[model samples]
Each structure stands twice: as structure tokens, then as C-alpha cells.
Target: MSSTATKTKPSTNPKKKKKQQQKSAAKKSSAGDATGDSKQKRLATDPPLECSKSDFDSLLVDASGLADYGEASSELIDCARYGEVDAVRAILDVWSPGKSKDGDLPLESGQPARIVDAADASGSTPLHKACANKHSSTARLLLSRGADAHALNDSGNTPLHWAASAGGSDCVGLLLDHADALHSLGRGGRLDVLLKNGFGRSALTEAFASGDTATVQHVLNHDSAEEDRLIGGLDRKDASEGEADEVAEGKSEGAGEKSDDEKGIVHEFDFLRCSEEGEAVDSNERPTVLIRELVSGMKSMRGNDCQGSSASRLYIHLSFSRNPQPIKHADDPFGQAPEDDTTGLGIWCASLVMARWLASPSMVERMAGRRVRELGAGCAIPSLAAAVHGSPAEVIATDLNPETVENIRHNVELNSSTSRAAKLSAATIDWGDESTYPPDPVDYVLCSDCIYQRDIVPLLRKVVSGVLAPGGTFLYVAPDGGRDGLPAFISSMGKNGFERAGGREAPEGYRSNPLRSGDGEDCFLHFHELASTRYVLYEFRKC
Candidate 1:
């Protein structure tokens, strides 16, 4: 038989070629599968690969009923190891920790499981895992489901203690809140507690040691009763041996000549040292040197603008300057004060704002090279100083208070290099309103003493969020009045997808000198986030 020769035709589509390749590949897999030459044949592949769920069940059990307890319960270990919340919950519901089906043995072991303070072998429970990974929502779920917030791990650290030392104040706040509700009043009306860390310390101690004042204050300010309890035993001493000895000796030499006021101030300093935790510790631990330097500098600046062109002055001031002018509309938040009068240093908001910023230098450095606009730039001292020293050209100085505007001009002259002073100007700005010549979306919005009223924060937030670039920041420094302000701010930010970064302790060298006290107490007033009293350099960036 003769075959007729025919021309072969090639498929034009690329899909044809791919199909051929896949067919050949399929043949190879089939061959391997038949000879068991795949993963099973490759012993050198270490442990054999796990079977798929369907296959594993086929070999492991009869699906109609359940697997034996020993084998079935072991699945919980894998669930926990993989952090599978659903699987763990399922296992927990089926194998609930207490008594077994026979009413004799516990679900975990033959004996009954401890109820209130149970922990896993690794010294952790579901709560620890959630907190350790900063899974806040998961932690809340666990807490609501009856996970003990006070249960200690092998290290003896309750969730609160771990949260504090770990430096996430949100966690600390959560745990402290839980502790508050559960605490029982003792026979003598004292608050009973739980949740001690390995060091035998409460969450407050950890918060204080970490220098997270917001956390400390939140934990402390939960109640007047809790506040007294947390602060009760903590000794706040100021005079270490070296400083006290010198003060004592100096007093002896000036004994008769020293004014009674001077003696009282010194004595008060001693007492303050004993009361404030920041000062109670020894020289190596206490913030004394920095405090002394600030106090000394404030003494010399007496009536002059402390934040003027001097390098040292720039280093100290942190807020926008308050100026005096027609910018002071009836709507101005800072009450009216006379313009062109430099003598009224007694209640200058600008000066107080500057003093607060001096509490943390690192925080000031972080704002460098960003578009910063001050809502109420009193004296414009801080803004001018920032423009000259750190971030320049991008600072918009504004004041709604007229006296602050005039003072701002004076301060600009006081601090600026003549060339830079010419470049800086103070203007009037009303927050929460659109500006005609709004500068490039502001990278940072700075405000000081703006939280006197609770309602003002929403306004501030609206202005900040609206004016800021996508990742812009807000640096706010307010002394105690907005008691629950930070939480509200955080909640608002969260709705906008912003979270709190760690805050820093205010610098120790800062002192409220202009607001003098005839008494010797070291006036260590603190600014707080929420209800916490901490001297902080807070930073909040846009989501």
C-alpha cells in the first residue's frame, strides 16, 4: 500500500504550542505518580509532606463519628501554634477547660483546671499572644470572652505590666481599664487589685519606668481612689546627696543675709525632690542636671524674650508664638492683652508653650524640614526660632491674639539672624476656616494651649486633618484641661486611620520660671493624652 504525501499544516495560534507543552508535562507527572517517584520517592526531601485535609481525614479517622479523644484533642495544639482563632475557639468550646464529660477529669487533664488565674505551660494564655503581637482587637475579643487580664505568665507579668514595659500605651490603657472594673474595695475601703508583673510591680510602675506618662496618667487617673492608690507609695524625692549637700552648705553661708523667700524656695525644692518620682531617685537616675541648667537659664532671662535669636533660646522653645494685634477678634481663644507691652511676662501663653517644648529636644528635631503652620503663634518666638534653626521657609506664623502678634515681632527681632528675620512674618489666622493663600498642604499643624475647652479638639482635629498632607502630623501641647482629650483625639484619628506612636518624656531641664512660686516646690506640671499626666513630646501623623 502506498501512502499519498501531504503537506503538514502548522497551527498559527500561540495557544496550540502551549497546549503541546502542557500535555508533555502532564505525561511526566503521570509517569512519576505511577512509580511513586514524586515527593514520596524523594526521601532526601526530609520529612514527608503533609497530606491535604481530605486525604489526611481518610487515613486518620472514620468521618461519620469523631476521632478518639487523644488524637482529636491534639489538633488544638496545632491551632494555637498557628494562631488560628477560629480553630482554637472551636477546640475550646468542645474541650472547655473545666470538667470532662464524666464529671471527674478536667478537659485539659484529669484534675479540675484553675478558674481565675490559669496559664498555659509556656506561661502565656490567649491574652499574652494578642498583646505581644499588638493584636488589639483580638485582645479585646479574648477579654470579652473571659480571658483573665490579670492572669500572669510564668514570668509573673500580667497583661497590663507587659503592655507598659512593651511601650504601647494603648495596651496599657486597655489592661488598666479592665483591672479597674474588676477591682474590689477592701474592708478598710482600700482598692483590691490583681495583675502584678514578674518584678512584683503593678502596671503603673511599668508605665512610669518606661517614661510613658500618658499610660501612667491613664492608669493613675482612672478614679480619684485609684489615683491616690497608684501614687501613694511612690516616693518623689528631688535632692540627691550632691545637690542637697551643696544647697545646705550654701544656706549656711547666706543664712542671715538670704531673704526668707529664697530660703523657702530652696526648702520647697527639697520637699519637691522627695515628692516627685522624676526627682526621688539618685543623681545617676534622676533628671537633676538638666533641671538645674533650665532653672539657671530662666533666672538670667528674667524680663527678656527667652526664645529670641540666641542659640540657647531656640533650643528651648517648642510652641507657636503668641502675638498681639487686631488678629485678636472677639472669637480669639486666648483672652485679650495689651499690645507693645513687653513687661507682662507673667501670663504670656507663648512663653508657657515654649517652656513646655523645652521638655523634649528629640521631639523638636523630628519636626524639622516639614511644612509647619502654627494656629495661634503667640510672640511667634517658637515658630521664628524653628524657622531659623530647624525647618525653615515652610513655617507660617499666625496669631488670633493681637498682643501676641506684637510680641511675636519683638521676639523675631530678638532671635533671628537679621537676614532670617526679614524672611519671617507673623499673620492672623482663625483655625477651622479656609485660607485664601493656603500654603502647600501643611505637613505639620502645631498648637499650644488649644485644648482648654473640650469642644475645641474636634475643631482642631478638623482643621489638622483637613489642612494636612496625606501623612502630615499634628503637634499639640496642652496642660491638663482636656482631661479626656487624647482618647477622643485618638478615636477621631482612628476613624481617619491614624494611630498613636510612642510619646517621649518631657525634657528634665524645663522649668516654669516666669510663673514663679514663693514656695520651693518644683512646679512639674504635666501635659497628658486622655487622662494621663505625663510630660510628653507627642507626635501624631495622618493616616
Candidate 2:
């Protein structure tokens, strides 16, 4: 009996204990399932990360059995592209200017909400698309709503660039006006007329390439107007101060003599006139004449008795007179003779470099049977070399100045027999007048030492675009004349669909020989230092 009492406390209830443990485990598992189901339900109710307008319209159609909006109900981009003003406004109203957790805004907000400057996959913003499609009202709206005018697309093109490429004169005008305002506020630098795209082209260049005469003229006019305003303002200010000083000083004994000297003083110094055959000439003493010999590659032609070999060279003679003569035509400022009649100052190193480059064997082969044209043919040396040595099918040397045109004609006639293989001619061509351009496209264009004036760059680009053929070549030579406009010129060329093929420094032997000093006894070679006004040759091909 005592042993049974001690064992009663250890009575086994294995089935009941196992059943209770099973119930507890089942409750825990049920709670986890409920929590997981709740999470799934919440996830199902959430909106999609990116919802286009089309998707929303589809959802509404499915819910209400309504007709679909089709292509019209796509997104903000579609609205802009299709010129849906009301739709764009509605979408922009609720759109917050920021990114969401999913990087892009959620589509549930009625049109995949986009910020004003938000770009699509192609990196084109609403402004870019609007201007590109020539939707002036849409572009105005976006610009008014603070869209970035300078925002770059995938091709590094601004909204203005697109406008220029599309030949939208109104859009170009609006963007340029906006740029002026930004520049005045010191927000942008000089309105960046020289700003380049991915293709290294400027807005001005694009306008010219598109063959939109109105747009091109508009751009040129804008630049010229800006320059005039700046120059006029400065001139006015200087005149005012000068008048005040003169009034204060009253009538002086030397006033008449002073007026004569002031009138004689040359305000603008032409660098090209300073160096004439290495001879030291006083600035006041006008040059009477200039002579230069441009030498390049070796030339040899078999003869009966002996082998004829001589350095390829062209002799250029230019005459000048010391008098300020009125231009023949008032409308043609470029056609006017220089004030002092010193039109042909010195042979630009660029001309010599271009002559040598075109005379190269490879370049000559390419020039075969090609019509060539040269702009600003100062001495016509390059054009002469191309015709005489390069063996082009035809060559036309053109100049804006009448004197230069006559000089080029003389040189062409002088070398006519030598350049018998190619048809050569000289003409007075004004770049400002489009009517003077040739009717047919030219196979090649040559420009050397012509981009000296900043205001003339746009006109030059226009002329090049008009005259050059689709697959033609443009050979440009520039001297480092302390002007920072070369970069802008090159950028403009690129915008006009001209791609840079190659560039090089002026070769040593190809440069113009230095003029003989006093008595023609002490001869010194006129060499341009690499650090100074060195010549640069550039080759570009039109695409």
C-alpha cells in the first residue's frame, strides 16, 4: 500500500498533453497565416510604379465599360507631342516636383506625372519635343511654366537647337529672347550663341544647314543687332565725354589742327598690314605695293633634253594707293575698298598653308574632276595652287572687295597657262547677298583668313551651307590673330553638318618667305612662332 501512494503522483496522461501542445502550435500557425494574408491584400491594393495615361484609361474603361482614349491618352509626353493643352495642364496641376520611391512617379496620378524638365528615355523634355514638333503654343506654355531652355537632350541639343534644326523661326526667336533675358540677369553667359551640341554644332549653324532662309536671317539679324547695340552704346558714351571735355576747354588755338590729326588717326589697326615683306614701314606711310612668293612641294615634268624640276611656287603681285576713297557701292561694305587702299597687306600664312595642303598628292587625287570654290580669296594663292597643281575640274576664286576681286582675276590670268588643266575664274561675290551664290553646288569649299570679324561668322556659315554639296569637302585655314573666335567658327561648321576630318600646323618650307630688308641685300625669313600667330589648317567633310 505505501509503494502505490508514491507512484500515484507519476500518473501518465500522454494523449491529453499531446493534444494540448498540438492546439497551441495550431494557434501560432493560424496567426502567422492571418498576418501574411493581410500583407498580400495591402500589396494588391497598391498602385503600379509607372502608370501611363493609356494604362489608366484602360483601367477606367474596364471598370466603367467606356470607350478607350487610344493614342490620345498616353502620358505627359504624348499630351505635349499632340498639343493637348488642357490635358497637359491637368496633369501638371497635381504633379509634385520630385521623385518617388520607385525612381519615377507613379502612374496612378492621372498621366504618369512628370516635372517640367523631366526627360523621357531619349532624354528629351516636353520643351524639346514641343519645339521639335513645331508646337509653338505648347512650347510657350512649357517655357512659361519654368521648363529649362538650356536642358540638354541625349544628343546634347537644347530646345533652341531643336527649333533651329526644325526651322521654327518663332521658336528660335522666343528661345533667343529668353536667352537674352537670362544673360541680362547674369544667369547665363553671353547667351552661348556658340554653344555646341553632341555633334559640335551651334544653333546658328543648324539653322543654316536646314536651308531655312528666314530662320538663318533671323539668327544673323539677332547677332548683328546685339553687336550694334553694344557698339552704339559705347560710342555714345565716348562721344558724350569728349563733348563735355571740349566744351570745358573752350576754343583752343590748336583746335583745327587737332581735328585734322584726330580724323587722320586710324582707330582700327589691321594686323595683316603691319608685316610687308619683312620691310619696316611707318604706320602713317601707306604701303604702295606688296609682292610674295608662295612655295610648296617639288614639281617635275619630263623634257626632251633634260629633266625639268623646280619648286612649286606662285608669284603674287598686289598694287595699292595711299588715299581714302569712297566705296563704289554703298550697299556693299565688304565690296568697298579699304580706307587707305592698303587692301593687300601681307600674304596670310593661312593662304600658304592651304595651298601646300591642297597640293599634296592625296588631296590632288581627290580634287580630280571636282568643282572647287574659294571664299575670301585675298591673294588667290590657294585657289591658284588648287587649280594649277591639284588638277580640279574647275575653280572659282571669289572676294567681297572689288580690289581683291580684280587682284585675284589678275593672278588667275597670270597663271592661266600653268593651270590649263582646270577651268579657273574670278568673281566679285558678296556673302551678305545670297543672290550672288552659284546656282549649282560646289564639290569643295576653301576658306582662309576670312573669319576675322565676329559679326561675319554667321553669314560665312550660311554661304558655306548654301554652296557646299552633300558629300563635299571644306578646307579652312586660320591664323592665330589674338582673336578667340576660331572655336566658335569651328563649332558653327559642325552644326552645319560639317565634320572635322583633320587639322595641322603650317609646314616650315610652305610658309611665305620673309621679305628682303633695305637694299634687298639683308634677306631674313619671316617665320611665325608656334606660340604666336601660327597657321592652322583644318579639313571638314559635309555629311
Candidate 3:
């Protein structure tokens, strides 16, 4: 067999050769590169080892730009679509976080997003392809490298939609854990709520359409049995403590059912709509920091930290704003501004009151090594006080509003001590969504002036039940105004498996009369009026 007999490839006809040359010239002119060079192709080639830095860097730039320029396929995207984990990992290993690309995700990170999240002409990403094909490993790799789970394709289907549609329960589980991540807030502004597709079908609907029972159940109950091993959280700790069997058995038997102990003993306790548990403040344990002083020091660093008792130097950011409209009642010192936000940019007396309590030597000493969380912590003064003064194991300051959470983080950044800063964290948490609760049940849930409306009591109670550990304490602060908020909380909590442990007026020493009188009321303008107004603290323990 001669070479000519075996391989007769060349076209000898003049017209055909001329036409082929013309087509080739046109392709070269259009493509602008005729060598058929590939970048990040090392990940897809034989051997499949990570490429050298020089090759990877050049390839990273080229592969990163392919989707942006409207090409349907790139080295990374094709590798992921083929379920090439090693290839995807090799590409990602060489990718740098500092290196950003134009992904065009709905809520991208400022200017452009991560290359792992970049989309092609069909709005499909490497992640979407991996999920759509049920390639869990490749999808996980892409997610670990910052893939946006909620990114939509041309048809408005998120990675979750494709994962559920493919009946990829494993992939669906991973996406659910991060569904609302990367700011996937639709009309409701919920981090745990995944948006529906353009057709109004959500991931859950897609799961049902797939007719996969496990997928449907997993979608319905966000916390599946494999949640700990998969998404991970406080519940995982039970396994290490040899309590996995009991816990798993209990969840399996009666996950949504409340046992007798959980059934509140409302029959035994005498409760009233506007009644409180107790009204006694120990004179010996009273706070020395004047409530008036807190009003002045709130906007800055001076007296916020237990009246500077903590050795750690701390600072805070608070912008004074006028009351959207001045209310006749001086009870709400830090009332809503723009007539919408009950707590605005300014610090509230409730937060200061709680901060004063948290900074107390008794509370501070008891809080050490405890996990504490504060809801609606404007400026996060109480949470910061716990972190700085008490040195709690961790203090999470949470709010439903992202702007408020950002402000909380801003305050966390101003504190000078790295250790204290490390102990304090800020996150957006919704009271209504159980999925948004911290992975683990918290030891203590603190609230400051959050219960002012009858509507949110149920949500607050729901969150408290979801986040609180057995016998964990919930300390709620609300002013004793004629508003139905506090009364509603008192009425509902008594029937929700909670025991009202104690109640007390914001200690007499911590109260001052409103009239600024042009004295030491320089901290926040309207709040000076709230500093002296009365606040009641209620302690409820989960049974």
C-alpha cells in the first residue's frame, strides 16, 4: 500500500481549489487567526494535566473572552459540558480570583463577574451545562470556583431549573444551598427564595415535572437528611457527638410535628395581651452608663462599647437623618424615616439599651464563650458590645435589609482589634424563611425594638423557633408605647413553646426624660428624645 493509494486527499480541480482557497481566505479574514490555536485547551487535551503558568495565563484571557465575544463554545465550557471534572479543575486551578471576566450575571460583582459564571450565546454557562447534563462533580467544581447558581440563560432558566429538570438531585441539592446567593432577590427581597423562570415555573415546579420523588421532597424540604453531609451546618455537630442516630430518628419520625413539651402550656400560665412576666431590676446589677450618655456617644466611638469598659478600641458609622415625618409621640426616639424604615441610619435607644445590658459586667461575663445573635440590630451596637466586651464565641448581627446589614458590617470593620472583629459578623437574615436561619441553632437570640408591628410577630416567632437551641434565651426589647407590637409578641410567644422567664423596665437609671434642653444631646438628633423614653426587656426561654 503506497502513500498515494492510501491517502488521496488533495483536490486537483482548478475551480474547486480556487473556490476552497477563497472560502479559506474568507474564514481567515473572519476568524483573524488561521492557525486554529486553542487556549485553556490544555485542560481538554490528552494528559489533561494543568498547563504551565504562561500557557494558562494566555489561555485564561482567551477562554474568558470567548463567551463575551458571542462564541458558543470555549475550552472551559466544552469541558464542563462533557462532564470533564479534571479538565474543569485544571482550568480553575490556574484561574485567579483577581482575574475577572464579563459574565453579565444579573447582580454581578461591581464591574464584570467571575469567569466561572460567564455565559455563552444561549446564556448558558459552564455551570448551566454541567447541571443541565447532570454532571454533579463538574457542577460542584464550577460552584466552588464562584459559579452563580441563580444565573439565567436565554430562556430565563437558572442552573437550578436545569438541575431539577435533569433529575439531578445531587446537583439540585447543591444549587438549593446557594439558590438565593449572589443577591438573587426577586420582588420579595429574600436570599433563600429562588426566582421563578420567565414561564413562572420555579425549581420546585421543575422537580415535579421531572417526576422524581426524591428531588421533589428535597426541593420541598430544603433541609434534607443529607443536608449536613451535603450543605453542612450546626446539625452536623450532633453526628460527631454520637447523637446522629437519635437526631436522625427524631427528624425522620416527626420532623414537622411538635411533641408534648413543644406544645405550649398556655393553660397553666396566666397571660394577658399587655401583661409582662416580672418587673424587678436588681439595684446591684444596674448599669452605670447613663442612658443620656448613650444618646450622645451613639454616632461615634466614645461611649458605645459599654461606656468604653472593653479594652478593645472600637468605632462605628451612623448618619443622622430627620424623621421622615415627626411623630407626635416622643416614645419612638429613633423612629422610621421616609415613613418606611422604623430604624433608619441613626442609632436607636433600644440598641443602646441592649448594648448597655450586653456591656454590663454580669451580662458580659455570662456571654463569654456563648454564641449570640441580634436581630434588627441597627448599627449592631449590642452585637458589637457582646463581641468586644463579653468576647462571645461569635456574635452575628442580622437584619432583613441589606443596607442595614452593610451598615452592620461597616461598624464591624471600624473596630481596631482583629480578634474582636473576627468574633463579630454581619449577615442578612429573614425572620419568615427557615432556610435563612443560621446552619446551627443559636444559644441566644437578641432583639432590639424589632417587635413594633402585629404583622411581624409571627415571623419573629417563627425565626426564634427555627434558630434557638433547646432552652436558648430570646431577649426582646420594645418600648411600652400604646402600639400593639409588644402586646402581640407577648400574647403569641406564650403559646409557642416558650416560657417567659423574666421582664423588666429598661432599668430606671437607663431612662431619661425627652426634652433635649440643648444639653449633652449631640449624638443623634431625634434619638435624644428616645434615650429617656421607657423600654421594657422581656426574656423568653425555649422549652
The Cα local distance difference test for each model comes to 0.41, 0.51, 0.52
Residue 490, candidate 1: Cα error in Å is 4.2
Residue range 198-305, candidate 3, lDDT tens digits = 655556546645656555544544422121222122112212122222322233223344342221100000001111222223333221110111122123231232
How well is each residue in 1-543 modelled by candidate 1, as lDDT tens digits?
001212233221110011334423433442223212122111011122133455433423321123433433444333333334444344444444443232433454542243212344556665665455444544554555456776666677666655555554655555545444445422122122223544455554454445554544444433321322322222122334443334423343223343322221121121112212233323323122101100111211321232222321211111112121222232322234323222222133333344345223453476655666776555443464455435444666665544445445544433344213224666665565667336668777776544434566687777676677877777665433223465566457555656565455543333322221211112221111111223345567777
Candidates 1 and 3 compared: the better one by lDDT is 3
> How many clashes (backbone N, Cα, C below 3 Å) per candidate?
36, 4, 1
State every prediction's TM-score relative to the real structure. 0.33, 0.37, 0.38
Clashing pairs in 3: 512-532
Ranking by TM-score: 3, 2, 1
Q: What's the CA RMSD of model 2 in angstroms? A: 29.8
lDDT of 2 by residue, 195-264 (tens): 6677656675566455565555445434322322212222112112332234222222233323221221
Regions of model 2 farther than 4 Å from truth: 1-346, 512-532
lDDT, candidate 3, residue 12? 14
